[model samples]
Target: MVKITNKEAICIAVLFLLGSNIVIGSGMDVQNDNWIAGIFGFAYFVPFAFMYARIQALHGGKDLPEIANHLFGRVFGFIITAVYTWYSLHVGALVLRNFGEFVKITTLTETPLLVIMLSFSVIIIAAARLGIEVMGRLSTYALPLVVLILVFMEAMSVSQMNFDFVKPVFVHGFQKIARAGFSAFTFPFGESVIFLGILYSLKKRESAYRIYMTGMVISGIILVTLTLMNIFILGPVEGDFYFPSHSSFSRIRLGDFLQRMEGTISVSYAITCFIKASVCLFVACKGIASVFGLSDYRFITIQTGLIMTYLAFILYKNTVEMENWVINVYKYYAIPFQIVIPLLIWIRAEFKNRKGKRPKKSEELEINGGEQEEAGNEF
Candidate 1:
């Protein structure tokens, strides 16, 4: 089996968290307070990382599906695995849809969504078939460049920023900020739970906690900083734009000659989205393979990618419906897989560990009797 170091795992996590986030900034409804909401959401996700780490620790090197199978019967375990597989597949489809929409609106106004999706699907399938180690290494190499470009864009935009626009904070009260926080937590932060599949490939299983936490912290900083940059540059109008980061970056004028820096955001977005979708696709393919006892996951990667592309087109009638579903339903809909099931499994694993540590009644009695005999002999 291929093994990934903690560093590679961290890179994967960072890019995965950035996947849709760079394209769709969180807490759009909360306006200027979106960055604050993101911070709170980051805090909310810390325990989840710990929980996922605990689950990893309990099982050593085993993935979530394997842990379920060991704790539950094969049938139930396979069912749980199937559920997670579907979740990954669904998420992959959503990301693809987001990509298609972004490309349609911004870059290729003339192209059909289906053709764009097909081109992306072919690329995604090819990447997924290359396997996890390749994906991890690609993230390791690509993330630094993408992040650097993003930072440069933010720096360039700083000259045009007006921090005054972010003034009069909390004017809308904490309720809206709290709601945005919840949205941030469920959509992106909680989505990290999908990393459970890739965690199995880590070379140092004991370092999973550190890897998860580090990745979250780094990505959280980037996300919050980007949001703040958007607020500063775009002011109250940030929320008005669908892709504020791109809009903000486009406003960056470098020396009057180099103006359109939106391409920086696009590059980072594409790279991050590729990493995120690839991870989801990899997990889905890998999980399905585990369920069916297949020796290789690549066997199904293309088929799954094609299905995901189709699902992307048909998932919503239009972008408005898609946005509505995301705002109204997605947060609640993702709970079971993200928090509920993992928490249950973690609880069960802890209970089993505690039970295993305790001596049986018969063993306790034998120990007492042996202690009494030892005392008599000493006397």
Candidate 2:
């Protein structure tokens, strides 16, 4: 197995969470209430950051299932793994479907949804097969380009920005803005909880927390800044339109030479979505492998990819329905597995540590602590 450095782990985690779907989805809410949403996003990270640090501290090198079984019994461990696996696949499908719809509406109006799904799924499978190191390296290369494009887009729109749009921002009352902020925090920031699986592969524990916190802060800043820019350039009335970033890009006209820069934003979004999907796919496969006692993870990627594709098709009948589902269902359904399960694991770990307990002797003998060891053997 390839050991990941703390910096590499952080980069992958950041890119995985700050991808196109998150930025676009969260950016929409921020446009409505920039300051409030931004603060909410920042606040959402507090609990997650603590849980993540505690998990790593308790079991830095172990996978989720192992950690679960270490703290809970074998049955509970398998249940937790199953829940996380389901969440990963469901989220992956949601992202894939969302991106496909965005492309159909904005760029590839004539392309078949199946073709779009297949193309993206094939790329994700290939990336997972190559292993997590390649994903990290790929993100390292792609992230800077994405950031540069965003910076340019923001800079070009500066001249047209009307600070008056954000004036008297609280005129809508703090409660409405606060609600929007909570929605923003839960989706993009809280979603970072998924990174715990991959992050344990990091070599340096100290750097893990620093990179995670830094990435969270940076992502929050970018999101809030983009929200403010969208509101300033497009005005609140126009900003409320679907895909405000796309709309903002469409309005860019630099001396008639640099017009219709929406494609730039589209390209960046597509790349980010690709990386995010790949990361989710990897984690799902890894979780399943851990649960099923598999030695080779690549074997499950294609099967899981097919399952994800089907799930994507079933997730939403149409774009509007998908957006509604995301706003309503995702928050409640995802939080228990994503945030609550991990919190439980952390608490269990702390309790065990305080009482000075370890796994039974038979459990340690069965797996010998090998990375690929199964929970049944360990328990």
Candidate 3:
């Protein structure tokens, strides 16, 4: 039934949390203090992760759609599920578009972005069709390789890093750093809501708490380290670069031998991106299947992939537009699904639990009466 071990789940979660942030460089706008922003972002998201885990625990491995149905009833639950379904599909498309944009900017200048997106969609479709178990296993194996490459590259570039660049914390004041942290918190960290779709697939439902906390911490550390590396390597000019982590790696040179390790960075990016996209696609397919009462989610994977690929093309007209949306609009757009809806669900769950635990009026009256035969005893 598409079950996966906690380790596999962690792998998927970490990779999904890592996502394009490794390439996009989270909180880059804060420049030298981006690490601080990363810390704040991670801090802000931890509680939400905890809350999500609590929901999972309360529901006994039921996914979001099922939980919604149980908590909200048919009509409202279907509506909520529909919104979640759209969010999953929408986020998946945006991530695919991010990949397409990255390729078009860095590698395939001569090729059309649409073609690249479509090509990537094929792989994502296949992965989603294979089910969450296969994806989880793939993630378990691939995450380490990606992390190793990242650490190796970071180590090699260490010689070039200047610690001084990261100094003078809050030079632009705490406001800017806080804003960047808020932005960072929303895009990738808060996006963990999508995991609600697959949390039910865990072999041990209780592992949800460990999985969420561990995954978020690992990804947050990676993002923070990457941000620090960008500051150390690129310094003040880090803000000028779109993908600071990638740009930093490109600058790596050792003597007359080692140089230009963009390929390594590219491979790592592709691996993480593929894992993220696959998870999102799987979530979308599974959510849809649940909403429609389909027997299998695999039936809709390819069709959903096709639709997302097309949507990716129309998502943004240019890089500037995309960046503007990401920096300015996405955080607000994501709040409803990531924070608001989840908060509502948590509240409802709590209220229902309290209601169930409260004694009925008859029971309360009987207890208050304290022995109905007190009159006979007195006589």
C-alpha TM-score for every candidate? 0.95, 0.90, 0.94
What would the TM-score be for candidate 3 when compared with the true structure? 0.94
lDDT string, candidate 3, 179-215, tens digits: 8888888879998899888989887778999999999
Q: Which prediction has more favorable lDDT, 1 or 3? A: 3
The sequence of per-residue lDDT tens digits that candidate 2 reaches over residues 273-321 is: 8887888898899999988999978999999998999898877788778
Off by over 4 Å in 2: 21-23, 27-31, 357-379
Candidate closer to the true structure by lDDT (higher is better), 2 or 3: 3
Candidate 2, residue 177: the lDDT equals: 68
The candidate with the higher TM-score, 1 or 3, is 1
| Candidate 2 weakest ten by summed lDDT | 21-30
The Cα error of candidate 3 at residue 106, in Å, is 1.5
Q: Which stretches of candidate 1 lie above 4 Å from their native place? A: 361-379
lDDT of 2: 0.75
Query: Which model, 2 or 3, shows the larger TM-score?
Result: 3
